[model samples]
Target: MPAIRPQTLNDVFQQAANQARQKLPELTHNQQVARLYRKSLKVLSSWAIDRDIFNDEATKIRARFDQARGCKPEKAIRLLREAEDEIFAYTHPDPYCNPVMPGGSKFMRNPPLPMDVCFPDGNYPADAPKYEINPDWSKATPENGKAATGYVLVDFGKKNME
Candidate 1:
């Protein structure tokens, strides 16, 4: 697995949830949007369920792994429910920490610039009037090579775009 720690994941999830929550109120309340919001809540609840909170799964699995393992019913499901309740703490906040809920993109006519797109080098040229990923996009990769960090700049010059 990656270097994901509980603290880091919580921070990331909290930030994303905050952003999503911020976006939700801006959306027009309607049946469809409401349904989507409910669905996202369901997803959030599922993520809240954890094996670590309650060791039932581990206990059962461990027993099974044993050569003379004892067969027993899993009480882990109860632990999972408790985990869900705890996770709901962050989710219940006005600025949510979960993406499952409705948010900015879902509500906006013109979506806000995503925070993830902001990079250290810069997205817009200094001379450019507007924010863009690259000043010249059609050519090969920028002479600086490219960021192996997954995202590459998409330079959109101000006057060039409609």
Candidate 2:
């Protein structure tokens, strides 16, 4: 009868890492381009505040992508990156302009009161006392006071220690 050996932590981790690496598919240039095209189309569909306008823009984007279909690997990659950047910049759904009233993409209006002065009463109740940290070390409790020291060295090469 063969003796069964227990798997070490490193062996188990290595097996899991190898499996994860093997599961990832190596996509070809055409596949990558198709994926990007589909993803871009989906993003544009979501960004389309108005359906008709979005459809027109999407059609234009599709035509541009189609024009670069037969381009070389380097050129295709560059074109795809440029297209992604353009799409992101043009259809940015969340253009965070301050004052944030309906559609102001420029300067922010000043608040009626300063942030600190606005909340004069403070967030907590009136009865709650403000906490202040004492500089004296004698008053502080040790963070690991209850932890066992014996097992500390045994955790050498453990998952979290790494």
lDDT of 2 at 65: 78
- Kindly provide the TM-score of model 1 when superposed on the true structure, using C-alpha atoms: 0.19
* lDDT (10s digit) by residue, model 1, range 1-162: 797656677889999888888444543323433444354444444444674632554454344334222323243334334434644554533332223212422222444454346544566546644533332222333443543544443323211211
What would the TM-score be for candidate 2 when compared with the true structure? 0.41
lDDT of 1 at 124: 54
TM-scores, each model vs. reference: 0.19, 0.41
Candidate 2: list runs displaced more than 4 Å.
1-15, 84-162
RMSD of 2: 16.7
lDDT of 1: 0.42
lDDT of 2 by residue, 1-162 (tens): 999999999999999998888566888877877887886776676566688988898898789877777878788789878877866776545532222322343213443343336457666556543443221211222542324433332121221110
The C-alpha RMSD in Å for every predicted model, in order, reads 21.7, 16.7
Q: Which stretches of candidate 1 lie over 4 Å from their true place?
A: 1-72, 95-162
Candidate 1 residue pairs in clash (backbone atoms < 3 Å): 17-96, 17-97, 17-98, 18-96, 23-104, 133-154, 133-155, 134-154, 134-155
